[model samples]
Target: MSLDDKPDNTAKPHDRLAEALASDMAAVDALIAERMASENAPRIPEVTAHLVGAGGKRLRPMLTVAAARLCGYEGSLHHNLAAAVEFIHTATLLHDDVVDESKQRRGRPTANLLWDNKSSVLVGDYLFARSFQLMTDTDNLRVLSILSNASAVITEGEVLQLSAAEDLNTTEDTYYKVVRGKTAALFSAATEAGAVLAGAPEDQIAALHDYGESLGIAFQVVDDLLDYLSDAETMGKNVGDDFRERKLTLPLIKALAKADADARAFWTRTIDKGDQREGDLEHAMELLHATGALEETRAAALEWADRGRERLKVLPESELRQMLDDLADYVVARLR
Candidate 1:
């Protein structure tokens, strides 16, 4: 079944997703707290906690725990690994806010907002170090390799995005390459580490990695879509933020793919150079609608989610495994 097949909670269907997550995420909390407590510098602890406690879906660590359960893991190392995954995810968000000059996250003031940029940068480094230490403590070379390589790819992806911004020449291939590196890399690493920790068979491990990678790409695609379709109150950020920042995301990329001469002039003047003005956003939206680019972007996310669910078929039937599939769907269902 597809991840989109999740039970609708309020209408005629009841979902037991929370019950499945509760089975494993309680220990994940302690692990996260323990990892966050080691900021030896007094300022370090407070600042990191602000970002750490900002609250997210905890999807990466959840992937670790879910993969472990699907693989029949019964040991406690999943706890430490889960924390490691969380630390990495939080560190990225901390650094991302700084890079994006973002003042808010998860509907609250960002660490970079509450504290100075320097504090956010240093605390992010601290979290990175702590993640490395925790992963090393597990003494699993494969796990370390997976996370470390993903880190490298994530940095490369960020750099790629930096370079791609405002470049109207960016293609769908380039967009996928960037997202795969920035987002999918981490998801793959988390699930692969979970399976490796559990001693899952090689094929199953590969399948889990594919599952996470697909889910991650699908999740990011939907996020990019929401920027155009939702309000800041619901999306937890400003609409047209990407356009303001001159960041070329999937919708923009698709719109660019079909830009006519006049539309091209509009984009090159406003979007590429960040020379936004009255009616610029609306005009851009018109181009995207006319070209059907928004629909195409959403379709791409749906295709990735379908691939993710298909990969899950490699795993045996179980509630936890089924929940993972549903969670994948939930990530992209926002687009629909």
Candidate 2:
């Protein structure tokens, strides 16, 4: 099923939080639309609107707004920061689609596939520049520092992932580094910047940062797991797309680590050499199951989710905190 197929009225943790913060989110939506506009270049807004209009969870920006609210931020500047966070995320998606040669996002055609790669890449750059302009409006140096560092780390992570792709020697430690860079960096920044803007105490700021980091790691682990187990309709892309792309995600990496002679040869032929046959994906899934890699990966995701929940305890107890706690559980719930 597509994201739209998910039941709207269901009491998902994110839905509950969004409902609670409805007014603030509406402000954020307005700010995003206003900021994404361009006078001279119609193509910029057109490309951005296509991706932004495709319904997303808007989880990162929500984290920013929620963190600010949790820390008693009463001003409207968080809305600007939240919109900036979203622009950064959407910009990354546009760049990633071109890099991955992706055909679909959110069950719709990717910006790169629908337009040209040049348009996607240039538009992504424009969004990145726009995001910086928005963040500067906050006039908080710390917030700017956190976001700039995250942008740099994300680019570094993508480059590292490019080097590690299909390399069988990629260890779990290396995998964590990549995840922390590419995915967790923005998550931690979103929360940390909000707290900084709120003038939160150092301990509270640290707690929110840790919470976002752990949650982001768990989120990516579950995504990697789903790419193997979920169907195209549910995942918004074909199952085993990672395998076809020669990405050495957790399950496949674990399976390869334990592969005997025959298994190693199979991985080498399909992943390293990219000489996939008809039943290669099925056989790869069988190996993941037989080697207990899938279970192991699930366990890791659960551990990270628990880590995120524990970090939330440092914040004051409130309904928002509970929602954040539930969000951590919901991230890995798909594995069950």
Candidate 3:
């Protein structure tokens, strides 16, 4: 089913935005399906269909379409760009599942698990190529440059994360670098490219870029926080997956920063050496709470959300603008 066909009577802010841009979203979805097809290789469409039909929120593409509309774009080229953005995000998910050995995604079996790692990785590569082809359809060099750079940054971020994983000494600065590269880069690119496509004013484009960057950071921080707080059902993925993977997310990093000697040893054994015993997750939760890491992480997300909202003030007033502001609040609302 198309994204608009989903019955969401009690829709959240992003859902409401999706409804507002229903026509554009429909066009984007159609383009996505058209581009994902490959007559020569049936496996390509099979793998792409499984993940694309998995019911993601499509937030990144929505941001791209919304930004273009907010900037008074009248052409349909934004549809292609939005589809490209979604393809990039889906490709990342497919690859990330393989890299993390993830079994589940979006509350369903992951592509890697349902098929195989080779299928997932190759399909991801195909999607990346498709995304670039879509970008070129616009014939806009600036948009191509922005998205290409984002793809590069995303790869760098993933590599940096691999290096930082299981290292308790990974500093907040390094963490921010990873977040900016992997998460915020695409977000900023999506908004900036939309504005560039619309030929919006330089100041307005800059403002939207800043807004996306902050919103992306807030979104990632909240996702990390939910990893420690929410259950498997609520979060889709397993809770404490980051802990099990030894990824140094913000909450754990904050806890480690404030760790006493005993806490340090516990982190070293479980995270550094991968010597997790029974009840280690419970103990880790206790340390996170004792150090006020969860609370602090929540506060940081709130701050970034506020920063995103503040950046929107520079843009002209409109329904899309209000929804964008609300979208920022909605991202971190789960924490409340």
Candidate 4:
């Protein structure tokens, strides 16, 4: 199924935006298809098509289009800009699956698993190059700079995540740093680039950037929470994947912060030592509850969602703005 075909509540905030932006989204899709094509290397398009065809909300690109429209832009360049944002996002996903050794993505086998790691990496590189080309086509220096810096920050975040992996000493501050670099940077850049493309005022651009940042952070936190609480059908991957992977997500970090001696030992054996076994995941969940980490994490997500909503106040009061306002709550609605 395509992004629009994914079964979801039509009344949901994102769905509303999707319906409103249908024409623009189609144009963006056409741009994506045109740019991802390769006559020299067939494998580049093949691997890219595999993942791009897989269902996703296309939320990052949508944010770009939405930002531009909200800024009163009536031009077609936002389509190229949105497509560039998607290429950046898709490139990261391809690289991430390899780094995580993930077998599944968007409820299907990952590009790496279906083909090979080398193909995935090289194709991802091709996509990155394509994204740069798309950005350059806009001829907006500020937009180009914002997107390029976001790409660098994303890479830096992934490296930081690798360095911090399995270390029980990872703090909440480090967790935010990782989230901002790996996830929020693209989100903020997507919106900021759109606003820049539309020649939006500086204050409005800053507000959109802040809104995207908070929304992205909240989205990541909730995703981590769902790794423990959601089913495979809901999450597209098995529950407790992060626990099995020994990744120090927000919930785990919060749990570790309040760990007692025995709890610390359990974490050490299961996480630090990478000696996870059956029942360990369940015990980890129990510890999360015992430490109130899950609750704390939930509250944090809500707070970020609220912050994102607040940032939208600076934008004009329109249907798109209301959808964005509602989207902040909708992002965390699953927790409810």
Candidate 5:
């Protein structure tokens, strides 16, 4: 389930960055769970922690930590903020898996698959509440505003996606709208909040925010591309899962536009009606290739990643700055 078989280019850079930023020695992990855990509700606490304990990239929270330090944040409260960001991300995954009826995530059984959907939903709610509490503890009005606004945007994005499902008319604009809501909003919040916590200058904070938004969009574009390119072992899920679920992600949407009458009719039948068979995946892959849909999508990701790198120039030269640039490149490089 390794996302990359190319020896993980990010490992050395990530380790170096971690050593440099250097959060609390033992307390960050503890604080992550402690902050996510619910009180006066034993079941909720344990269940919420179970999902938080589930392994992930920890990318969003790490951005928060990095932003805080790059901005010269000297306070310990940034860790709490990082934990809150992680909880929000984990909660979204729990809800997303349920909504998608997905059984696997990050190379393992999804929470909804291992447990019941009921537990997954309830635990997700508990985590969201806990995340809000953690944010409230930060006592920074701007921090609360950032996370809260992002949460609202995320929900709106999900709702739009739900409506867009099985609709063949989904456009590239629609795809960008979905990515902005479902992916970029949180990334922007995580990084922007970090800068805010550090009390960085307005221009610097805005640069990080833009950097995160572009990087997030790039990350999602690669994800959509991988849905067609990779198998379950590499991608952590079956190829064409989004197609089987009738999700109107970028790959499918782009293919729809380029489809000829015959191909368009096929799309209507399979994508719009959810009538698919074993060969359907292969056929759709062919359409994606012949129509140049995959390449078009990959180009969009590359453009965003490049813009993200450009945004990093706003930061002063340092090891942290270089790592952030590399991180942006990594998000979109999976396509290559």
Candidate 6:
């Protein structure tokens, strides 16, 4: 379904931004469709279309377009950049589902589940290749550099997460680094590359980069928090999937910090040891709340969101800027 399919009463800041950039988004969509097609390997488009056609918020691509428009760009090159951002995002999602052995994404069965791991991985590689081609179409080396660096960082972050997984001693510092790599890299690259394409002033570009980075960090923290607090109906995945998967997130990290002797054993059994039993999730939730980790995680999300909003003050005040600021607020407001 398209962004317009959402109810008017439910219109969020992202919906407002999508409406404002409908024409450019349409162009990006066209480019994406044209690039995803492959005659030699029909499964590339099949796998990609399965995920791309799913009702995602399409937030990353929209960010590229919005950043360009906010910087007074009148060219059509932003559409290519927007499409490139989306391809990179979609590629990552495809590979992530494979790595996580996920069954669902965006409220539907994952591409890997529908097809196979081999198809998902190869198709993701194809999309990455397509993204590079699109980025080079602008003939701007700086744009290429920004996007390429993001791709590398995203890969590094995933590997870092794998090493850090199930480790109770995982620090908040490492958590932030992982979040920046896995989530914020593409976000910052999207906005920064767009500004570079628009020939925006260096200061404005840096501000947009910081804004996107902060926004992405807040967005991921909220996501990790929601995995525990939200249910499958709202979150699409089973509640406490991260706990079951033995992943170390901010809430768990904070709780680990405050764990007493008894709590430490519980964490060791379920998180570090990965020997989760029935009712362990409920007890884990209790510990998280009792230790104030959930509240602390929520506070961190809000702080990052506020930092993102503050960064926007450097840019010219416009409807797009206000919507971007509100978007930052909205990411954390989901906790309410």
- Model 4 Cα lDDT, one tens digit per residue, 273-333: 9998888988998999999999999999999999999989999897788778888999999
TM-score of each: 0.93, 0.96, 0.95, 0.96, 0.92, 0.96
Report lDDT (CA) for all predictions.
0.84, 0.92, 0.92, 0.92, 0.82, 0.91
Model 4 bad stretches (over 4 Å): 1-10
| Candidate 2 residue lDDT tens string, 1-336 | 112233344599999778777888899999999989999999999999998899698899999999998998989999999999999999999999999888888888999999999999999999999999999999999999999999999999899999999898898988988999999999999999999999999999999999999999999999999999999778767899899999989998899889999999999999999999999999999999999999999999999999999999999997788888999999999887
For model 6, state the Cα shift of residue 204 in Å. 0.4
Stretches of candidate 2 off by over 4 Å are: 1-10
Q: Evaluate residue 187 in candidate 5 and report its C-alpha lDDT on the 0 to 100 scale.
A: 93
- Report each candidate's C-alpha RMSD, comma-separated, in the order given: 3.5, 4.0, 2.8, 3.2, 4.2, 2.9
Pairs of residues clashing in candidate 2: 1-234
Runs of candidate 1 with Cα error greater than 4 angstroms are 1-18
lDDT of 6 by residue, 1-336 (tens): 132333343578878788778888889999999999999988788888898899588899999998988888898989999989999999999999999998988878998899999999999999999999999998899999999999999999999999999888889999999999999999999999999999999999999999999999999999999998998888777889899989999999999999999999999999878898989999999999999999999999999999999999999887678889989989998875
Worst 10 residues of 2 by lDDT: 1-10
Decoy 5 TM-score against native: 0.92
lDDT of 5 by residue, 114-179 (tens): 778988898888778878888888889999999999999998889899998899988889888989
Lowest-lDDT window of 10 residues in candidate 6? 1-10
